[model samples]
Target: MSSEQRVLHTPDPAERENLATFLSRALRLDQAAVVRLRKRGSSLVSAWVATGFETLAVRTITAELGVDDVTVGADTVLAGLRTGHPVDLGYSMDSAWRGALPPMDGFAHVDDVPARALVELAERGADLAREHGGVHGPPASLLDQSVLTVTGADDLEVQVPMRVVFALTAMDFIPHAGEKAEARRIQPTELVRVRATRTWLRLDARYGSVARRLGGGIPLSPS
Candidate 1:
């Protein structure tokens, strides 16, 4: 809980750059955003941010953070990384995260959808938003509509909102049409995994994951 900026280390340049990209996306979504860093174990740290669309985004990377959990300003960490400044994450915003982190375990495997499918859905959502949105952006009905529903074992079904898809693309979680020709040429048939608990629904993409409240009991099954 130090007011002073704290330092950490990520020796691998690739991982550091990836983290930088995630933080930058978060800042772009909400300029006053904060990133919560939670050590997953001895090797990886989960960096989480609240996507402005009622969802949470996380990108876990390997690093030596020396601590278990802390929250800091996204812009501060991004600046430190850009300037080679020892990842001096400034001003512990421990209280900034106002919601509970999803449980690391116990999520039921609901289904898997193609990454390309998700990318396409996001694109269509954007077009619809642009056509109908105004000063306040897309209408709540569009954002909250159940655009997709996947059924799973034990009679489980969940509806995915356009806002979730928007958050996914906004965070650059899934690969899409804008990749370089070289990257597009080798785009793998990666799948976006869907999982859920009684309280939340999560979509895991190539780069990160986005989750939001289910607004009802999951599974729609008997207890």
Candidate 2:
């Protein structure tokens, strides 16, 4: 993953017109509407399809020199193009679809191994929380001057220290015993806010410890 952000360049009139025609047909629009095309990096293109009224639909289309490729991402981007309603293009669905994270700052790619590992860890965490009657803390946290080293297959590693916010919930109970009282009463819970500078993610290699516990066989050997 490169630290430098990808740039988007405005498409020329011919390019825009071609994309508009394609989008109009794909989206089943009655009128041939004008569309906006922005060059993403070197190969990917982002198209803003007009709804012909007030709003516009934005999607990332896989193209090389304004020529659309017959790929899953390109087809998905075309199919996803709509009118009137808003769609949230949260993260890139695959490598071919390079949807920009809005306000666009930087780019990072997560391969299958890491993605599966993360998912497995999450499931294990949830299971532990449910069985132990406790809540799991946030998986990732932002640190002012701290970095998290993520190691992947082939000894690939990166230090990501970006700012992020996460929420966590916890439950606690007070134990009380009285000769006159047969049952304990539940008390109202209060919220407490605290500030911290650092966070940690623990990992182990045991088959039923974390990742393997989820039955995904994601080899996440965190140290």
Candidate 3:
């Protein structure tokens, strides 16, 4: 399959409920009340529905785990550019989404392929949402992301390079009514943080083995 043709599944009821509960707890809102609020006209499943909110979550999670800044691959960069969207990769769900970026200037840059792919995704998502007038059907959607990063080494003093994936979704938990025309489409974007100790150098030897073992890197050859 083409890299741009990534599959993003819908969220199940259980997933929605978990997200709702998590939001309620994080925002200190009553679970039942939160659910009700979510069901209200023009609403979001979680208070963290804003586009930037996801980016914030990514940065925070990465830092907390003591991982360096995240980097985007050529595919990601190209995807975003093509689709007018930004996102984390598929493997992120299992790998904790923290070590996605490869270190560079204390931050990570988007890979060419994914950046362009996002542009197409953005267009598709926006078009789809526009068609429904901002009402997503029963099942919610997801967008996964994989990133590259540089890790700190204990003895060699050479930062170990790595790639990680963080998955994201573009979902409409509750169908909102009277939402502004702009609110119908969720724009794709990215947030990069600086705090690593390496520069641009695809040390595939160093990271390739680790990525393969960790199940994060894309298969060099299609299966």
CA lDDT, candidate 3, residue 57: 16
- C-alpha RMSD of each candidate structure in angstroms: 4.7, 20.2, 19.3
In angstroms, the error of model 3 at 97 is: 17
Each model's lDDT? 0.81, 0.29, 0.25
Model 3 weakest 10-residue run by lDDT:
57-66
lDDT of 3 by residue, 62-158 (tens): 1011112222232332232233232222222222223233321232322222222322444455455456533432113322222333333343122
lDDT digits (tens) for residues 67-103 of candidate 1: 6788889988888777754687766887667777777
> Which residue pairs come into collision in candidate 2?
none
How would you encode candidate 2's per-residue C-alpha lDDT over 75-104 as one tens digit per residue? 333333333122222223234322222222
Please count the clashing residue pairs in each candidate, in the order shown: 0, 0, 56
> What TM-score would each prediction reach against the true structure?
0.87, 0.22, 0.19
lDDT (Cα, 0-100) at 79 in candidate 2: 31
Query: Candidate 2, which ten residues in sequence have the lowest lDDT sum?
Result: 164-173
